[model samples]
Target: MEDPARLAALETLRAVRQRDAYANLVLPQMLRDRRITGRDAALATKLTYGSARAQGLLDAVIEACSDRPLSEVDGSALDALRLGTYQLLRTRIPSHAAVASTVDLVRAELGSGIAGFVNAVLRRVAEQDEAAWVDELAPDPDTDPVGNLAFTHAHPRWIAQAFAEALGSRGEPLKLALEADDARPAVHLVARPGEVSADELAAIVGGDVAPYSPYGVHLETGAGDPGDLEPVRERLANVQDEGSQLCALALTRASLEGTDDRWLDLCAGPGGKAALLAALVGLEGGELIAVEKAPHRAELVRKLTSGLPVTVEVTDGRETGFVEGAFDRVLVDAPCTGLGALRRRPEARWRRQPADVGQLTTLQRELLTEALRLVRPGGVVAYVVCSPHLSETVGVVADVARRTGAEQLDTRTLFPEVPDLGDGPHVQLWPHLHGTDAMFCAVLRRPV
Candidate 1:
């Protein structure tokens, strides 16, 4: 009999390979449906996400052991080998059990014809030390720096070069970024402004406390179960990145002071920021209307901040009839290539291609063009992305600002604590510079 957790893990990887599904998206639901819990749930998540993230390295190890090309191997066997190799290289599971269980999984899935092949290959893989295998896989640094970095660090070659070019120093920043991607992401939470203060929620999460903004926490030890925590389930808190919380807070700080107004979250969906903004604006006795294109996602936004003051609508922000100069502030947290969130979304690093950026930029520009009419004269419109890609971040904002008359405001005036937030009309935060998510924000004030 096979461990159900391991079987689920294998099945999840198969889904990712055959269906072009995302591991992060599929695994949570799978785990819930099966009622996998505690250590089993955690290990399942690790096996699924880690195997996906380190597939390139696992491929190298598998290829070294096999006589045939990886493409020639049965898909199920390949995934089984990858999962077994992932355990050996990336996890502390007992080596024999890892190999044996994976072989069993392969035999069960692909029939007995390939079981011996699976066993033989995985046995050879387990026989050699990981360091030796890594050396064999690592490209010569002098001859193929990009390939070397990609293979050794388990990154796509183009992505490795992108980070190298973006970092410029090249001394160690790229390696550090790659290392960060391998680590488990810290759980970040947001306190609903009207319902919970930062101090109250911080105590529950055992995180650092802060006063204003109603959004600060730095849980060190025992991050613990969020659901078991009181504030979160009570609708007084929600999970969100500190960077995203900062972005929403910056908008509130940069908004026109002394005005009771209507605000629009132009591209709100999976509504983390929209919910946080709603709490702030609502506490101030202002209206925050969030517009999401999909009805299902709009319903998620509604459920996420159920008790908070917010109006969720199912409509496309880009084409939604903007009451000419109707809103005091509008936040276009526009869609873009989600390159910045690689650490959180493991499959994203592989799933995204360079071409996706081009398509996303076009949508981003269209949304920005329409967002101009949504904000009132002398009001502010904050354009933000979870990415710091040049084309989507600065290029789109600059293009819209040039076409429209909106003037860029100093971003540091809003997030002074963020050092790389920089002294410019806009701000771009890097994961290397700030522990926060790589995000870009541009505040453009419509002339009064």
Candidate 2:
């Protein structure tokens, strides 16, 4: 029989590629179903995530080594070859062990004929080190720096260009940003106020308080599952990125002049920010309305805010139809391409395409417009996206501000503790700079 860990990884990869499934969601359930735990689970997790993250580079190397085009290769055989090549190029698993184990896996799954082909391709792939293979296969950096960085770092070329464009005049931040995305992100937990403090959550999870967000606790990437923790089960804390927590908190901290008793979270789903916002709103004797278009996600939002002063509604946020001046504060944590969160979801970079941006920006603009309409005059509408793409971040905000004549508030002042924020009325956080997802936040207000 093949190594159980390798078998698990191969199954997870097939699920991701064939079914369009998410690795982060599929892998954990797989581990549970297979009764994998401890070190074996860790190995399987690494194999699955690393192979998914490096799919672009591994396919390039596989094509260089294979006799036929990768498309012509059998589906099962191609997945087996990707597993073997990822091990050969990336992991410290010794040559003889990696090769022998993978050949066994292929033979067990695809029979001897395909196993022979996989063995031959992987042997050729194993002949060179990773850097040498990259140098041979990657585009020339001097002539095509973006393509070079994309191939070398295992990102789509368009995404690399988007990051560079978002950085603007900042010197070569793209490479650093790509490298940060390549690294696995540590899990972050937010201890909801009036429920559990960050310090208390840290003690329970054996984690440290996050530097930027007062509510955040940083845990090691594979420190078991966050759902299994007691705090999470009790809803005292939930899995959240530090940057996301900061974005939600920034909205709460933005100085508004008049009544602040009512708040709206347009497009709130799977309810992380809404949970935090609900807690904060409750503390001030206020109520929060969380609207989501999908019923399943709206159910999740309801579950997350079960005991809080929050009402979850299943309605399209772009057409929420609330009174024009109903809310004192509004948050449009808009639907986005999720480019900022590539590290946490390893397969996302490979799956996303440039065409996705235009559709997402359109929805984002509609949602922001609705959010602005719902807020009272002089009240704040915090526009946030888990993306740093220029079009999605500033372009959406600028166009909306211009069309509505909303005043853009300087967001840097809201988070006075954060450093190196650049010249911004809007705030863009980076994984390399902020140790958080590339969340973008801009606070806009209707004229009184």
Best by TM-score: 2
Model 2 lDDT per residue over 273-296, tens place: 999999999998999999999999
lDDT tens digits, residue span 282-343, model 1 = 87788788999999999888988676678887888877875788888889999887767777
> What's the lDDT for all of these models?
0.79, 0.91
lDDT of 1: 0.79
- Alpha-carbon RMSD, candidate 1: 2.6
The alpha-carbon deviation from the true structure for residue 394 of candidate 2, after best TM-score superposition, in angstroms, is 0.6
Point out where model 1 deviates above 4 Å: 127-131, 206-214, 218-230, 255-260
Residue 292 of model 2: what lDDT? 93
- As a whole number from 0 to 100, the lDDT of residue 13 in candidate 1 is 90
Q: How much is the lDDT of residue 357 in candidate 2?
A: 93
